[model samples]
Target: MPSVRRLRPVWAETPGTVPPPPGAPAPAAVAVQPGLDELGTPLADVTFVVVDLETTGGRAGTDAITEIGAVKVRGGEVLGEFQTLVDPGGPVPPFIQVLTGITTSMLVGAPRIEEVLPSFLEFARGAVLVAHNAPFDVGFLRAAAARCERAWPGFQVVDTVRLARRVVLRDEAPNHKLSTLAALFRAEVAPNHRALSDARATVDVLHALLGRLAPLGVTHLEDLADAADPVPSDVRRRSTLADGLPDAPGVYLFRGPREEVLYVGTSTTSLRKRVRSYFTSAEKRGRMTEMVRLAVRVDPVVCATPLEARVRELRLIAEHAPRYNRRSRAPERMPWVRLTDEAYPRLSVVRDVRSGTAHIGPFASQASAQLAVEALHETFAVRRCTRRLPLLPAAGAHACVLAELGRCGAPCTGGQDHADYGTVADQVRAAMAGDPGEVVAAHAARIRTLVAQERFEEAATVRDRLLAFARGAARTQRHAPLARCAELVAARRTDDGGWELVLVRHGRLAGTVRVDRRTDPRPVVATLRATGEHVAAPTAPATAAHPEETDLVLAWLEQPGVRLVEISGEWASPVRSAQSVRDAVAAVAVDLLLPRPPLLDDVPPARPGAGAPSAPAGPDVPAQGARRTA
Candidate 1:
């Protein structure tokens, strides 16, 4: 292997090479587990192999590399450079040939990846890897290593593109593209569409970024990875949206220019501080950055207690169906499996839950609801046929295969009369209404039978069906008790010697208050009773309220130190209900059972006029300036 030394007249001129202040983040917060960059090594002590690769195409594994260029640097000084061209084992695409100037003829005489990899690996050994859009170059290298059956060295990585986005503002540079950055930073070498020149430019960009970051206390190499994310320029400009938000526990809605809610979130402490975070790098998701960019105003709904804040957040998210809020947007779309109003009832997954019905649900999706229906069919020999059955049967009518298989009562053909079929229907209703012991027992028996016969595939399928049914029923049954209550009040002692009080009606949070230890609780309870919401009694299976809110209430009630202050309506479930059944079904861990739960359509709701939630759109970079990135 041969190494070339690229000489330069001037080393990097670091402007703010100041020392880090005490307790100041090196760049941002402390990392959980320190990587090589977080190992307290000063940036000067860290060696970086700024690398570039020109490939036959853009994709890895499918594309072959045509050339590689890398320059090793430490302490703001260039050490050595490595450059090579490799035959791609195939003709280069016409577009790539024109862009890279590496035609198929030029590559035909060069060594292949298998021959050149060893030399390059040796050159990059013991150095932190740096590249522009590191994933594209590094992904290709890792994929190459895998193809060659060689272990890709676990070297630390730094992405100059990402770093530049953080350190150099968009106003300073139009874009962080290699050529654009090279021109802005006044680099010694211009970046053409060649590997060595681009690599050389990236080294200059990296140094310039370091020079800018040094003032912000980015002294340690590890500091680069400590900050969760960088605040995009557009997002930061909207910091005024959080203005006037109070420092209190509350729900906050980010409203767009059209006054449409873009996101719903809650703050356990200060709404002002929490909302302000979205304008900074602290809010680290692309979708959120986009959300902040669109937000023109912030509406804060201040609450007395943290519990109330959380509940309000859930309600607002459901009401607004904010595109940025990924959860709690479509509570109405949650599928419920209902028993039809027929002589021999059949289970059907429905979005429009009828006023009166035997149903088990709030399943995550229609597929999951259908799985629960299948579990019922497997367990109770319930009618699986969808057609409406006549009360009087024809004399010459024939039974379907389910009747002979005993998986159904064949009520459609009069082989089983309505009276006899009603027995199985009654059992199904009982399970859905709360007591699912019989249903669970039946699934367990079938699982045992299938396992004994060595039909592992069928057994696994049955296992999933049972799990889906058991969990759904348990969720509904547990929520039903709380949902049925007319008025209920609870209290929990907070860590600050205050009491968190809540008024719940029919499983929905009606009112909440926080009373300090120094204040009298008697008056607070009276105030709550007078102002509590009037909730009409829900029809049976009883959780007419959003199941999510009911769940939140139940979890709060069951937590340690919570005490029931007052109660009006009966709040109780069957002694032996789906809860017990769920435990039993989950206990069965036979060999060959699927390691994961059955797959369901748990995807996010589709954006308006789109098939699914549209991904975040790319925003513009800053105007051209003095500093730049790779």
Candidate 2:
């Protein structure tokens, strides 16, 4: 090291310097007035206060402030400086002392943060705050101000880190750190891990960044915040592609040179903003950046509301299988768990849902469908042996292990009567139709037993299977009423004081139309009916609806202000719907998974005189997977 220079407070004897006495009132000049210029105000006219802080650690709450340094400048001229040593009321850790050269001894007799904060606030008044990494310094200041019962001045903040990332080329500087940038720009003062030196160094870096921004048309203070975002020249040149986009809810498609859709996306607020964002450096995904480079044109489809936009996006992705879009491209390939119609009904996973069959799922995957099936089998005495049993079993057909273990009724061997088997089959159908309380309760009881036995892994496995069954049952039951309905109209108010109307047919969204405020809605309704695509009623067992689109529609329907505008058929979730059973299962499952004390507390105590709650009776259906026992 050359020679260590003892540092003095930079604010001492500087122009407009005023050091108030300890515990004195805050200065009158400390009050910051809002800026006169709007967002488009020129950068050169805006005053900036470059600030830095040396602290004991990174956390604002736990860390003690050692020093604060700031430089106020306007039009590239220094207006004043603020620098002070703060008695943090705690000892500085040795590690911090080594890193910052600010020992605990140096803080002795220094003014507490409360004594120095008011003067610094006065010096930085009426100025935009700039810092290398703003959040750190700004966070500490705000925390200290709060502790001192002083209102934060609420200065507009700018971070040099963000600006440097936008403007400085990687080859020009190895990194955006203050020391590196100070040397790169040959600043007058070199940063030495001290607050004042580092802050002065930052002021020069700020000026250098401003110089680089001027050529990029970043004259306005507001534009400077995003000046560092690197928009490729080719993308910038193609900005006209978004000119025709509407400032309304819609989906947009980016097309490659060969007219192939490169990406599909939706925006609820503004198609223009969302589409335009792809051309700017704000889109940091590497794959997206490449996609933009390849894109030659933009396409927009306006929708009545965000729900329609989302639905359209899903449909478009499914139709095109766009290379850039990630989700809902294989909706047709999703699997469903169907209960085959037979004298001996069996659960099977099928790709296509046929008309008129009891089924549950448009499960995310084949494995998830299997899990749901497993959950149903584990709880109900549904036949698990995969034998195709005739109306009357063959005389010599042998019983399987599932039947031997009493997990299934030995229907294959004629050990059970047909009438008894039919009853079990009916019970299974009822469970799938939404009366899942018995299955859920059984699983809950199993989970509790497993936990008591300390078989936690087994308990977790049972819990997962139960959750899968509950979720699948809930989805099936909730959509069943809508699926049965021939047609319905629902309306929700839009943010712009307009009405968004949705046409639903057999649980599928037929069409959506928006009516503007002060506009007659009769014509819009007529137009919607004339142009809307008709969604045919799904054949029984209905295939699982597209979950994303279905969720969007369901959420809109459930919104507080949503109203049923019209209905051509009945649509209602039954009072004893599977959704309620799913909720009950979830609550019980959660209670079982918690630590022992709560788990024990939540379990109902077995009474000497009371029996377990009897399963509620519903339409008698055959027990799924269960055969008549010998």
Candidate 3:
């Protein structure tokens, strides 16, 4: 990890450069200093902590941030600056380093997120934030806040990107990328894309853009703040589609004029960014651009897991027959390898899942799916020539050329018995399921067994299959979650060999309650029962013969007359758990509840919770999958 040194304010330094001890009082507050105009007249000037971050990747929640840079500027004068590389806690993609020039070696000694976030928050206190793409910077900052258990800095934002688009580029700028705007204004940028250098450049860009917009009645900060960035009405409409969106893996739909669907797509990244990109891409204007002018709204459906998102997206496209979506009949007819229902198992390609056979894939492309089926057949040797089974003998009564080639233990030729054939079938099924961890384990075991018996060639083939399985699974599973709502269940072993239950609603740290494994017959039982409704108990972990057991409490709570209860805490998510079901019952709750913003509006005759939240969405990991039915 790159080391992070805390940024000190030049105007008002803390008593000591080091942080005050946890229980110590925070340093005294600093008053804002006034600035002078060119004529020596006092001006109501304000300072800004202009910040920028270069991250390992774009997905804020999943990707580790690699570097941070910020400078405090007052009246266009630099007061103080800070910069540091961050240890991503994961591998840094080569392209990221190429772009940012922050190599892995640069971060080897840096502080982790847990330490840097608080210091940065304090440095940014009492200053309005200025950035090129404000949301991109803010999104990562907000995520850091959530991780550190702090609220986002309550400062206002000034976006040079938005300002240029709304005020200066009224003639339709060719491209609004930072580099483009910088060139247009003749602003010189540093050679490396280091964070602090970039932040300073952005501050300069803000000043230049402000000069252009000042003549357009954008002199005051408040005027620029309130001016709706003159984005295409279509862009604005599509942007709203991200409102109330769960931070899970899912697909979204864009609708044009007269409710005609314009686009259908999936994103393992931010749904907000994915949908927003269509309007902001370089191909911003053209035939598509004209259609955007007539665009009315954006629609979305959140999925739980990446697997679930892929499945749900395909299902929804087929069902809705949306106007913009391309015909995806290929996925439906994609062949899957399945075992025939016979005394001796026969492998064959079935084009559809609804063929009344147990099958694995409706692969997006048929070619890849066929290759997978062929590879499995070669490894397992399951009667590829196919001349009606049971014509010659029982399940394990014969041998084929594959067994002689050391590729298969021929069950069809009786070299392998029925029971052993069943074992091989199970292995084939596991590989088909596309889970690498399990496949690796099974293949490793097979290789070890073969190698110990001096079957080197067979071991090599098993090793090859393992590698193939790993690669295939990676491509298929690299998607976001599908379910929109889920109960995040975590089980960690306690020091005394017990288990702990820590439940978080949304991203807030709601509560931590432990369960003792010895006396508790079932730990899941205890937690589920305590959900939504309160069941009184001693502060310590449960003991044998306790007055209230988890099962009994849950059973009684489920009764018709039992009312629903709500747990309280610093929850910031829109979805509420245990409330709709346990209302009127004693609620197990936290008291430090923050007020919630409104949820996004749904399309088509309007469903509930559609208005945009009065406050913006909290920066947290999006929940995945389709919304669960209440």
Which candidate should be chosen as best, given TM-score against the real structure?
Answer: 2
Write down the TM-score of every candidate.
0.61, 0.65, 0.33
For residues 98-163, could you state the per-residue lDDT of candidate 3 as single tens digits? 887778888898888888888887888888888878888888888887877988757788877777
| Model 2, position 524: C-alpha lDDT score | 68
**Model 3: runs farther than 4 Å from truth?**
1-44, 167-173, 231-630
lDDT tens digits, residue span 1-630, model 2: 222222222211222357789999887866646465433666666788999999999999888799998887766777777888999999999999999999999989999998999989988889999999998999999999999999998988999998888877899988999999999988889999899899989988888878777766666777776564467677677777788799999999999999999989999989999888877767878788788888888899998778888888988988888898878678667778888877787888888777666888677778878988998888767777655778888877888888878888887888787788778878777888746877777888898899889898888787777666656666665566567666656666668877777877776788888787777655665677567777767764352346556656666666566666555655444345455554465576567663321221111222222111112211221111111110
Stretches of candidate 2 above 4 Å error?
Answer: 1-50, 53-68, 71-130, 135-244, 541-547, 594-630
> In candidate 1, how many Å is residue 97 off?
53
RMSD of each: 20.6, 14.3, 22.5
lDDT of 2 at 519: 77
Of candidate 1, the 10-residue stretch with the lowest lDDT total is 621-630
User: lDDT rank, highest first?
Assistant: 1, 2, 3
lDDT of each: 0.76, 0.74, 0.52
Best by lDDT: 1
